[model samples]
Target: MALRACGFIIFRRLPPENIEFLLLQTSYGEHHWTPPKGHVDPGEDDLTTALRETQEEAGLGLEQLSVVDGFLQTLRYEVRGRSKDVLYWLAELRDPHTTVTLSPEHTAFRWAGLDQACALVQYSDIQETLREAHHFVLKRNE
Candidate 1:
């Protein structure tokens, strides 16, 4: 069976400048940077899994964000030689200045621009995910 995960590609707007994306540094593994995400629990729907993981990993809830509808990305990869599938939906924080509370699963977090976020994410699949999310927001703003 495939390992299923879900998360939000959360971004914030910074006036007098540009949009910034949120990336978290894991405390484990390669200490890689990724958006808030976690494994799906049994019997949970994908959207519920996304929200729960966001809350557990980043302390953000549905009320704290505005889900940007019609934007979803799926990434397939191998984690430790096992197939993993991760789904990400776009969201905007209700307040651009909201603080992030990281769980033990993450060591640090940053709000970065597209270039920096893509660089920090490292993996090609994740980079594409960020790019897609960026375009989704840009298109919405247009």
Candidate 2:
């Protein structure tokens, strides 16, 4: 059985239509960069997991975010001989001024634009997801 997790591709708009994405650097395991996410608890739905993890990891609640519908991305990968499936939903930070408080699980946090976010992230799938999220936001704003 594959391990399943969920998270939000949270973004904020900068000046002149520029978009910046939120990423957390894990304190453990090579400090891998990813959007706020966590393993789904038994009997919990994916979106709930995403929201819960986002709040826990990023200190951003649903009130701070406007979840973008119809923009879910799933990426599957191998972790220590186990298959891991991660679901990511797109969300826009309603207030770009909202402060981010990191959890102990994360040593650092970044709000990076698409190119820097892609370069900072280690996984290709994550980088691709960030690109897709950028494209989606650009299309939605148009």
Candidate 3:
């Protein structure tokens, strides 16, 4: 069976429409940066895992974000010769300047604009997901 995970593609809009995405730097292994995500527990649904992981990893609760519609993306990849599937739900941070508290799993966090976020993640699938989220927000508000 494929390992399943869920997370949010969290972002915030600054004045005059500058949007930045949230990425967390993992403390272990390659110390790569990714969104706040984690493996799903048994009997838990995808969105619930997303919200729970967001809170545990970034200290952002459900009250802090406005979940975006029509913006779910799934990516399938291989990790250590095993199949993995990750689902990402899009959300807009209620406050652009909200504080971010990190858990032990993450050493740092950044709210990066598109180019920086894409550069930080450095995976084609995640970069594409960010693009899709940005496009969805822009189109939704237009």
Candidate 4:
């Protein structure tokens, strides 16, 4: 069975129509940067896992986010020779200035624009996902 994980492509809007996405740097492995996410626990639904992981990893609670409607992306990839599937839901941070508290799972955090976000994440699929999400937000607001 494919390993499943879920998370939010968390973004915050700035003045004059700028948007920045959040990326967390891992404490382990290659220390790749990614959106806050984690494995789905047994008996937990995907959305719950996403929310729980975001809170645990990034210290962002559901109340701090406005979950975007009609935007979801799934990426299938291999990790350590095993198939993995990740679901990402887009969410806008309710307050752009909200403080980010990082857990031990992440060594650092960054808020970057589309191009920078794409560059920070090493995976092509994640880069494409960030592009899609940026476009989705722009289109939805128009």
Please give the distance, in angstroms, between residue 97's alpha carbon in candidate 1 and its true position after superposition.
0.7
Clash number for model 3?
A: 0
Reference-based lDDT, residue 108, model 2:
95
Evaluate candidate 2 by giving its C-alpha RMSD to the native, one decimal. 0.6
**Between prediction 1 and prediction 4, which has the larger TM-score?**
4
Candidate 4 lDDT for residue 96: 98
Candidate 4 local lDDT, 1-142, one digit each (tens): 9999999999999999899999999999999999999999999999999999999999998899999999989999999999999999999999999999999999999999999999999799999999999999999989
In model 4, the Cα lDDT at residue 39 comes to 98
Q: After superposition, how far is residue 24 of candidate 2 from its true place, in Å?
A: 0.6
Clashing pairs in 2: none
Q: TM-score for all predictions? A: 0.97, 0.98, 0.98, 0.99
- Of 3 and 4, the candidate ahead on lDDT is 4
Ranking by TM-score: 4, 3, 2, 1
For each candidate, what is the lDDT?
0.93, 0.94, 0.95, 0.96
Which residue pairs collide, candidate 1? none
